[model samples]
Target: MIGRLNHVAIAVGDIAKASAVYRDTLGAEVSAPVAQTEHGVTTVFITLPNTKIELLEPLGADSPIAKFLERNADGGIHHVCYEVDDILAARDKLIADGARVLGGGEPKIGAHGKPVLFLHPKDFCGTLVELEQA
Candidate 1:
């Protein structure tokens, strides 16, 4: 089952500008940009009181973020991540419940270096959901 809200991921056309808004304007604590080639995204994490905000920019022409940007000229919220005590168990339960997992239905290393899995947006009320091991 899901635990605490891990982070909210936002797809951004300009990660620097987006990071500046959170860092300069809102005075948030933003981390340096990190390129996640495996995930095909360059990310910046903005730490928050209750959770964190993840800014994602496409890393390549074939990046999924690029496709998302093509559909949405102005980038927006891409997904929401939740923590899970036992990801594999949660995954099995979700699967039995008819929820579809994204990718190859296997866990992958996330930005936090934690095991993570993405659920199909259609299965979660049109919002992509990420489950991270806690």
Candidate 2:
């Protein structure tokens, strides 16, 4: 089952600009950009009082964010991540309930260095959902 809201990810054409807006304009504490080659994204985390905002930029031509940007030129909310006590169990239960898991249906190391899995957008009311181990 899902736990607390982990983070809301926004796909951005320019991560530096977006991070600056959060850091300078909003006075948020933004972390340095980190390249996640496995996930094919370069991410910057804007820490908040309660949660965090993730800025995602495509790392390569084959990155999923590139495809998302192609569909949405301006970029937008890419996904919402929720914490889970047990990813495998949650995944199994969701699958039994007819929810589709993305990728190879296995947990991968996320930006936080935690195990994470992405559910198909179609299965979650047109919004991509990421489940991260808590």
Candidate 3:
């Protein structure tokens, strides 16, 4: 099952600008952008008291984020991540309960260097959900 709200991710056309808004404008602690080649994104994390905000920029034309940007010209909330005790157990349970897991039901190393899986948006009230190993 899901635990705490890990982070809220926003797809952005310019990560630097997005990070700046959270950092300079909002006075939040923002991390330097790190490119995640496997996921085809450049990520920046904005630390907050309770949770975090993740800024995602497309790494290439074929990147999923790129596709999302095409659909949303100004970029927008991409997904919400929740912590889980065990990713495999969560995946299995969700599958059994008739939820679809994206990316072939396999966990991938996320920006936090933890196992993460994306759930289908349609299964979760039009919101793409991400489960991260806690």
Residue 96 Cα positional deviation in candidate 3, in Å, after optimal superposition? 0.9
RMSD of each: 1.1, 1.2, 1.1
lDDT of 1 at 115: 95
Please report, as a residue range, the 10-residue window in candidate 2 with the lowest summed lDDT.
60-69
**Candidate 3: worst-modelled 10 consecutive residues by lDDT:** 60-69
TM-scores of all predicted structures: 0.94, 0.94, 0.95
Clashes of 2: 0
- In model 3, the number of clashes is 0
User: Model 3: how far is 119 from its true place, Å?
Assistant: 0.6
How many steric overlaps are in each model, in order?
0, 0, 0
Candidate 2 clashes between residue pairs 3 or more apart in a chain or in different chains: none
Between candidates 1 and 2, the TM-score winner: 1
Clashing pairs in 1: none
Considering lDDT, where higher is better, how would the candidates rank from best to worst?
A: 3, 2, 1
lDDT for each residue of candidate 2 in 16-113, tens digit (9 for 90 to 100) = 99988888998999999999988789999888889999999999768888988989888899999999999999999999999999888889888789
